[model samples]
Target chain A: MAFVLELNGLTKHYGNIQALRQVSLEIPQGTVYGILGPNGSGKTTMLGLIMNILQPTGGSIRLFGEAPRADHRQKIGTLLETPNFYHYMNAVQNLQIAAAIKGVTNPDIDGVLEKVNLLQRKNSAFQTYSLGMKQRLAIASCLLGDPQVMVFDEPTNGLDPVGIAEIRDLIRRLAADGKTIIMASHLLDEVEKVCSHVAILKKGVLIAAGHVDEILAQDDLVEVSAANTPQLPELLKALPHCKQITAGDAGKWLLHFEQGTADLRSVNEYSFQQGIVLDHLLLKRRSLESKFIELTN
Target chain B: MNLNIPHLLRIEWMKVKNYKAFWILMILFVVSMIGINYIYWYVKQQFVASGDIAAQAAGSMIFGDFRFPAVFKTVSQMSSWLLYFPGFIVIFHTTNEFTFRTHRQNIIDGLMRKQFVVAKLAGAFLLALVCTLLILLTSLVFGLISGDGYFSLEGLQYIGFFFVQSCVYILFAFTLALLVRRAALAVGIFFIYGLIFDYLLAVWISRGTETTLGYYLMPLQVADELNPPLAELKKVIGSTNQWIALGISIAWLAFYCFFPIRKFEREDL
Candidate 1:
């Protein structure tokens, strides 16, 4: 896969504390890569380093096959932290300045402002903006010059639920438009919903890194809930596809499948053949939060 | 390399234009400088027409007190005022970078740190020049209207001195703000240094047995000696003290520009 950004043995330190520890990551082109970690996990530091806002103590970064080119700066639109803009300038003026700096002419600042649902507030000073509006404005600034790479650090750091949903949809839309997005956030649920791949950092170390679906694809277990819990456990135990059946809380039975022991076909067949009724039958999918907890520890 | 200096200049210009405080302060400086010149002119016209020796001496006193030199030989009079508002304006121009965190965005937007610094310096230099010229022209026009006949070659020389002095003062102010990095602290120091420190220290030193001690403490002594607005100061104090003042101003400028740029280059955004 073509990588839009690549870090080679990237490490950084603040005083005696290490912020990043040889944590190299490749953000593939046209992929939304979520960087997941707790606070002080080098997430913001990594974004800072990428934008050349913070220099790495040791290591190097390449953006779109170049080493810190002005052209690369034009390619990447970064919201490295809570958006810091001239509070007196309105949204249009703010984006216009950004566009001018990037050498983009006649930029559709208004269009991007509209995309972020900030068109109506385009003339409002940033100081007068609500937190959500500020966030939208920041995102709008990033969309200037039609940059292919987007990097946001805690983009939803202080957004309401509706604001969060708006940002989530915006990120999804950006990805759908084939924009490569590299975002660092502590919001696992948000990342899980939008990110195709992720890297989880804990205390300056990358604890986990892979595709979201593949990372959560662990042991497959089926959850079966019924009124007659005892009879359900017994019924699951006798099934050929069931490797091991265990009883769970609230009249639930967990049937573990060893090496593709249970398929949807056999699951349906066995349930129909046994004449057993199940109140609920759902696939036991691994949640991102659980996976995150497992990795961070 | 054609590195798009014009574009960077445009960006800086837009910032200057949008900054309401900058425009308001500049306008205030222009209007006040002109208004004071007009007041001096009116007073001068009354004395010259009345043919009263006492009143003429009073006119001289007015010139002495206000220090609005009837004829410009160099920028000494203008330099004194330059030290006041234009320096503060220059400081504000650069200090806004730190206060607003716009410098970080400027970097992220693809302007090299070197280019950004150059743009700021250039912007400050141009603004100082324009503001000083405005004062010089307004004063010359007012002086001419009052029949002072001060708009001569000597007057042009004084205006030139004013321009150079303003630039130097801006450099001094720019460096201070850059080194300090806080709006209130930088601006406060600028005012105290320009308006208060020189006056208090000059008086305190001049009161002593050595009358020449004021030369060291007075801002004009340093400014006049370095810029040499009039040829008279060198005849009076010799070039040695002038060289010393110039050296001090240069050192201050170095500390202001280099120290802050170095610190900012290493600082995390």
Candidate 2:
């Protein structure tokens, strides 16, 4: 697969603080790649380094198969941290500045603003914009130059639920149009919903990185409850697909099966053949949120 | 780094185009320049009308034999007091980029760090150019209205020197904004340094050297000397002092340009 971005041993130090430590990952083209971490887990610092806003103490970054350069940056749109704009200028004026910087002579500023639903207020001063409007304007600014890659740091931050959903839909549409999106977000559910691939970071270290399904698809959990819960663990232990079984609350036992091996019928049949009756046998698919908590903690 | 001048200038223009404060400050500077020059002309006329010998002598020094070149010198000098207004404008312009975090956003928008510095410098140059042009236009109109014949235009080099002087002050303000990175703090330091610190330092150094050359060579002083107060005061600085002042001013300009670029190149934001 062609990689849109690649990092090798990327490290950053802010005086005594090591913001990023030897982080290395590759983002494949046309994938919604997410850099997930809690606040101050170096998500913003990493994005700043890659965008050349902050100097990396150590590392190399390659975009589009070459070293990062000014021209390379032109092909990538970015919104880091907050919507930074001239408060005295209106939305259209602010986007025009971005268009000029990006070297787009006939920039469809209105099209992008309409996409973000800020076209109506394009002439209003930025200071007069609400928080949501400011955020939408930031997104609109990033859509200039028809860039192939979009880098957003907490894109949906400070938005109402409706605004968040609208932005999420916009991101999905962009990705559908074959744009490679690299977003840094602390919202686990948002990342899980929108990102096709994820890299989880904890304390400046990469804890997990892979396809979302693969990373969250380690095993299917089966919660089986019976009248004799004490005897359930012994029965589950005999099954080859059941890797582990642990007691749960109120005469319930949880069974872990290897990926793609667990099925309700199989577990039921095994219990029936063992002459043990089963009351509850539900397959619990692992969620990204739970996996994230498991890895980060 | 490939530096595209037009592209950089366009970027800078986009920043200031819709900025109300920028226009307000510019209008204030222009209005103050015109208002103060008119007041100075009226006072000079009153001096000429007075019958006292000292008042007549002072009046003649300024207005009695006013040639077009002397008009240029008088008008440009009268306008120089308002340089701090443009200086404040430059300061606010530079600091606004940082205050709004647009400096960082601009980089993310694909501007190289060097380009950001170059664009700001270009903006400063443009402001200085506008100020110089206003001085030229004002002086030309005033000179034509107040004096006779194009023969008064003989000392037009003073106007060119005025342009250079405006650039020096604007770049000095730009350098301060780059170094301080805070609008109020940079403006404060600029005023204190230009009004108090440089004056005291010049006086202290001149006292020790027993020569006023030391005073004239200070950064602001050298630029101020470029368009001396009166036509006769031009002779106070010999040809050698003029050359020294020109050399020092150029050196200061070079520092103001390069030092900020170097510092900005290494800065994280």
Candidate 3:
């Protein structure tokens, strides 16, 4: 597919309760796509449906441009919801089962364990693992076979701050290596920092999608200040593509503009050409948390 | 059924090979199985010695419990009672998957729903075979040692019946674990339903009749009639026709084998 994954009106319900509604989106190849939502917003359910863990009540899914199949999942790495392993099996043994299922003739089990920093404790049973270690082991299992597409549901759910950052970097490095990743998380900041493309789900509805900047651009804000420049407000308002110019705290003017129109250089050059450049110019992009709350609300 | 069972079973073996509880239970089962038979044999020897001496003067003997054909029947009857021991293995393994949510992971790992369920049933089938093999070996030892008429194969068919019954019991336990999705509850229900409830109900329903609805009850009760404790009990429990007993066992077999495949495919993990 032009996209690595596609969902067309995917819907699921548990008897009278709807867990996921019609969610249709495409995850393009080579992009780290995020399914961003809050708890019970259907992120995990959506991921489960895609991986065939849960059957959809209504909809169609296309994996790599074909109808979804079990082997299609083999070509992709997926960790749904939690780190599920045999409590009695060690790390090497658990990954061996996953590798066998994925048809990987030889998986670098030790390499992945080392990558997740679980090599020292590789022989420990999963039940002995702390939550972060268990989560790391799950990620290590996903890295088996070096799949081109990887899907993770809350990859850093139980991680401490350092572990979370490490996982985020691993996701970034994997994406940089040209792999397509689909990660579902309730952590909006995680998605904002990591995802190139995003789909926001709120209460089972797909509320927003497309490029992250485009989604975050709905409330793009720019702060402009000059050395006691009396004409800054008038100049900002008169500038092209400026949505609004309003006064802000500590003697600043907040200029609102559409996505690309919020280019800080243009504000500087425009003010300079108008002989208004003097002190400060700043781009105030909205955090995903606010965007999420706004869109979800 | 699609011939991927070997690979699936290999994957299954990987899970249990390092599982200490599985091997512990298995060793305990085999040892207990053989040990229980030895006890029964010793008790039979004592009973035969004490009771037959007086009865022999009256022109009858009571020393045939371990005779060539009777030994086969006796061992199978004993083995059938311990089917639940291996059945707990099935319950633990099955419910452990649900408990750990690895059931979902297995599906996520690229096994078709059919492949996963079939592999599980295959595991059950193998476990039954293992139990049957143990029974067969024990029967041989007891029969030969008893000097039971030069090792006749006359009643060897009971061992085959034992395998069938074991498959039903283990798979029924697996079905309970899959449906119940919890260990204690599955074990509890299995004991209550398979042992007490099914037995008393089937017995009441059959009422020592030669043929009746109770003879076909599922899990253990259906097979209880097939396992001949008293030669006369066989006639009262199952129909005089062997085909009917075979048919009921096969029906239970087919249900346990294929129904779970369908359910796993349709149900959300």
Candidate 4:
């Protein structure tokens, strides 16, 4: 994949507090990349550095093969934090200011407003709108000029379920249109569902980075339940495929399989020959949440 | 969006329009200046009507001329406004950013720090220009009753002084706001700078100090001191004083224009 943004050994410090330390990552074009970290873990700091909103004390970042500058900023759209519109101005006016700053002229400000479903509220003052509408307004601002790269920091923050869903759909639709997105979020589920690639940070250090599925994949665990599972745990101890056996709740027995060992027909047959009746058997997989905890922990 | 400078300026102007309080204050300031001039003109008119030479000289001291040529005096009065108002308004600008928390968003919304700074300075300058013109027109009305001529070289110089002072306002207000990063604090400090601190320092120096520092401070020396036509007044104060004040103001303008721009651009907004 071609890298659209690359940062190398990035570091930042305020007084004695280090906000970012040696953060190096490459975001490829057209990928929904997620930066995951807890509060004060430097997620916002890193995004600020990448977007050229903050100067890094050390290291450098390149956007589209050039260092980020005022000219290069036109190519990127951003929705950082809450929608910050002039409280007195209507949605259209707010977007007008945004478009001007980006050097775009006479845009169908109404058109972009319509996409965020804010067409009706385009004439209303931003302070009059609900929090969800405010967020949508922020997204609408980001949509101006159809920028190639988009960065949203905690886009769903302080939104209700419906708002979150709307923003999620919007993000997904934008990604589907071949737009590159770098979303930094503390919400694990949001990142898990929308992101193609993920990077998890703790404190100021990147602890994990890779594709979601690969990062979350688990070694197989086959759960076997029988009428006499209490005895089955003892019976499973002899099998070479069984790395370990544990008694599970509901009278089930868990058989941990060795990595690269998938053939379980022989073990099942042996259980059958031993007069062990299998009520149900299934493989257990790790969820993203579980993997996230494991990785960060 | 292609960033259009004119479009941004227009948008900024629209935002300024929404500030009813600021415009109200502007009107109040101009009206007060006009009222003072009117009162002075009325007294002078009585003396001239009486045909008393001694009274006429005394009346000129009190009322001054109230005609278009008197725009010179109006310019002088308005020039000080240009110098001081921005420092006050700048607190509004800086604090509005903090109160509204828009500075962070402005950074995030793809606005370069340099652009934001320029837009503010330009906006403040534009506001100052409007205020200067309004006072000038008010003075012209006062001059109409006095039957004075309109638009002289001195009057143009008054305009120049007001314009330059407006630029100084832009520099001082913006720089102080950026440095303080808080509206109320910056404004309060500016109030002290304008009202109390500069005067106190000037009095302290003029009384006994050998430093002659009071003459160097623009805010201290310009208090009710007028400009342009005030060359005579300034001369009474000493040519060195004017030069020193100009030098200090320029130094401050340079700091605001460059230093804060660099600092804020590098800072994490």
Candidate 5:
């Protein structure tokens, strides 16, 4: 797979404190990659280093198969931390400045504002914009150059539910158009709904990284209850595919299957062969939130 | 790396285009330049017509045969007081970027750190140019209306010196803004250093050394000596002193430009 961004043991230190400790990641092209971490987990630091805003204390980063530089950054769009802009200037004016910095003479500022739903207020001063409007305008600024890769640190921050939904839809549409997106978010559900791949970070360390499906696979939890509830635990322990059997609420026993075990019918047939009639059998898919908590802790 | 001058200038212009305070400061600077020069001309004209020997001597001494070079020198020197306005404008321009956090945004938008420095330098260069033109126009108009048409190109060197001095002041303000990165603090330090601190230190040092060289070597003092007051224009700065002051002023300007670039290049936003 082609990687749009590659980091090799990237690290950062602020004075005596280490912000990022040898973080290494490779974001494949055409994938919506999410960097999941709570506050102060070095998510912004990582993004800032890759965007060349902060100098890395150690290691290296490559963009589009070469060392990242100012010129190479032209192909990537970034919105770091907050929506920073000249509050005295309006949306169009600010975007024009951004366009000029990107070496774009005739950027479609109107089209970008329209995409972010800020076209009607394009001429209003930025100071007059609400928090949500300011955020949307920041997104519009990032979209000015039609970059191949988009790096957003908390892209949905400060937006209302409707605004958040709109931004989520926009991210999906951009990813559908083959744009690689790297979003740093503390919102677990947001990542679960939007990301194709995820890397969980805790305390400046990478805890887990993989495709979303592989990281939080479907039907990892199976709850089974039968008339012989007392015997269910023993039978579950004897099954070769069952990784762990624990007593659950309401006289049901929870079964955790080993990796790649997705056969519910076999478990049911084994129970019947053992002369045990099962009254209830249900499969529970583990959520990304629980998986994230498990890995971070 | 090849710096795209035009594109960077466009970026700089976009920053200040709709800024109300920027325009207000610029307008006040220009109007003050014209208004003050006109008032001086009116007072000089009245003195010249008084027919009193003392008043006439004072008038001629102040206005000097209003010709090509002297006119340029006198008008340019008169407008020198207005440099602080533009200096404040430069301060505002630089600090506003920090206030708005647009300096960091500019880098994220693909501007090299050095390019951001270059853009501000380019903007300062343009401001200096406009200031020089205003000085020249103000001198030309007042010279024609007031003096006995004894036009000559002999004193035009003062205009060049004035332009250089304007640039030095603007760059000095830019350096302060970059160092402080806060509008009020930078402006405060700029005024305190230029108005009170530098002068006081220069005076104390000059008295101890028994030579004004120490005073003349200071940044603002060097620039100020380049365009001496009309009364002591020739006596205060000799040709040798002029060369020394020019070299020192240029050195300070260079420091102001490069030092900020160095600082911004290494600092984290």
Candidate 6:
């Protein structure tokens, strides 16, 4: 597979405390890859290493499948940690600086600001901006030069609900435009919502990683309780697609089925044909949050 | 990226052009530098006008010092005391990166570690050059005001020394700010050390060894005799050799230039 970013045996140590362990990840081109972890789980450290914000204790990083050079980073737009702009300068000025560093000439700062919904306040000093506006401004900077690869670390941090939704929507839109986005967040729902691929981390160790659907739980669960619960298991145990049968709370039987194959009506009809009167029946799709909890814990 | 020196300076300008505090500090530096030179010249003028016995006896030393070549040393020395003003500007500008964490952002935006630090060191260099120009302008004003009509580039090396002195002061502040990464703490330590500790350390070393080694030992102290405010104390203090001081001062300059680049380049931002 062609990779946009590749990390090999990457490790980081802050004094004696290891911030990131020996873990490797490869992000394919055109995938919205998410680095999901809790706080202090080395998510930021890993991103920092890739961007050269932090030096790795061991191993190496490759950008666009080549040895990373400073200019190689020019093609990657990044908002690491916070919206770090000159507080005294306005948004247009801040993007101008970013453009200058990226070697972009005659950059459309207003265009990027418009994309991030910050063009209206493009002339306001960054210090006067609210946290949400500041974050949007940072996203605006990341959009400057129209880089193919973008990395956002906790991009929605310090934003209001509407701001978070806007950012998420923007990320989704960016991804849909075939831009390769590598986002680092502790937000499970965020990864579930916008990420095509995900790598889970816990305390510097890689827990799991792959396509989101492949890595996360894709099971359909059925909760059925009959007045004679004993007879329900025999009926559920023989179901064609049922994978597991376990006793649930309140005298209910929970049966796991392969995703999208659990037919609830068919299960109820078969249970009734088996002379079992079902008292309650419900179908529950396994949430990514629960799967994230399972993987992280 | 147009990361050449001029482009680098242009980018640096973009950062500080709108900063009110930067302008305020720069204005304060220039005004105070010119202010001190003017006041000193005015005092000497007042003494010369008094027509007293001692004033008449020292007339050549006072009035003649402000003309032609001597005016360069006179203004350079007078302006040296206000080096802290520009030093503070350098500290604020550098530590502002850490304070705002823009250094990291700059690096993420494709600025090499060397480029970021080089830009900072370059800022200090530009500031030093500006301070030197101010000294030059002050020297010309003093020389023209002396009315001796005898102007020569005889002691112009003193003005050059003043430029080097300015670089030492500002880059010393730059190194301190890079290490501490806090404006207030860096500025505090810069003033407290440059004003108090550097002098005391040199004095202590001098008094202990009965040699000029002490004077040339410290970075700021090495340039003490360059734009000397105290001329008579040279004989009394057994002043350091100019060549030795210059050599040691250059070593410090190298430190001030490369240390920040090396530190930022080698470590995590």
In lDDT terms, which candidate is top?
6
TM-scores of chain B alone in all candidate structures, in the order given? 0.75, 0.91, 0.90, 0.77, 0.93, 0.94
Q: What is the alpha-carbon lDDT for the whole of candidate 3? A: 0.84
lDDT of model 5 at residue A117?
A: 96
Off by over 4 Å in 1: A218-285, B1-3, B42-70, B73-79, B148-151, B198-221, B224-259
Q: Candidate 2: list runs displaced more than 4 Å.
A: A225-234, A247-252, A258-261, A264-269, A272-285, B60-66, B148-150, B213-217, B230-240
Q: For model 6 chain A, where is the 10-residue window of minimal lDDT?
A: A227-236
Residue B93, candidate 4: Cα error in Å is: 3.2
Tens-digit lDDT track of model 3 for A132-213: 9999999999999999999999999899999999999999999999999999988878888899988989889999999987
Off by over 4 Å in 4: A218-285, B1-8, B46-56, B67-71, B78-87, B148-152, B218-244
lDDT (10s digit) by residue, model 2, range A114-215: 999988899999999998899999999889978999999999988999999999999999999999999999898888789999998888888789998776
Return model 2's CA RMSD, one decimal.
2.7
Report, to 2 decimal places, the DockQ of model 2.
Answer: 0.80
RMSD of 3: 4.0
Q: Between 1 and 2, whose lDDT is larger? A: 2
C-alpha lDDT (0 to 100) for residue B163 of candidate 3: 88
User: Which structure among the candidates has the greatest DockQ?
Assistant: 6
RMSD of each: 5.0, 2.7, 4.0, 4.1, 3.0, 1.9
Chain A vs native chain A, TM-score per candidate: 0.82, 0.93, 0.83, 0.84, 0.90, 0.94
TM-score of chain A of 5: 0.90
The residue ranges of model 6 lying beyond 4 angstroms of the native Cα positions read A228-235, A272-275, B1-3, B57-64
Summarize candidate 2's per-residue lDDT along B1-269 as a digit string, tens digits.
68997889987888777777889999999999888887877777687668788996777566433347677778888888899999998899999999999999888888989999988888888888899899888888777766656646676776777777888899999988988889999999999899888868876777787777655668887887776666555446332255566667888888888999999889799
Worst 10 residues of 2 chain B by lDDT: B231-240
Please identify model 3 stretches exceeding 4 Å from their true place: A218-240, A245-254, A258-285, B1-3, B51-64, B207-211, B232-242
**lDDT (Cα, tens digit) per residue for candidate 4, span B93-192:** 5667766667776666557777777677667767667766766666566655556444444455555556556666556667778888887788777767
Give the 10-residue window scoring lowest on summed lDDT in candidate 5 chain B.
B231-240
Per-residue CA lDDT of model 1 for A1-297, tens digit only, reads 788988988999999999999988888899989999988999988887887778799889988877776667877788877776777788888888888888888999889998888898788788899877888888888999888889888888778888888889999989999999888989888788889999989999887788976654445678877665467666667777577877766767778775345575577568767877667777775455666777788
User: Looking at model 4 chain A, which ten-residue stretch has the lowest summed lDDT?
Assistant: A257-266
Docking class of 4: medium
Per-model TM against the reference: 0.82, 0.92, 0.89, 0.85, 0.92, 0.96
True lDDT of residue A148, candidate 5 = 82
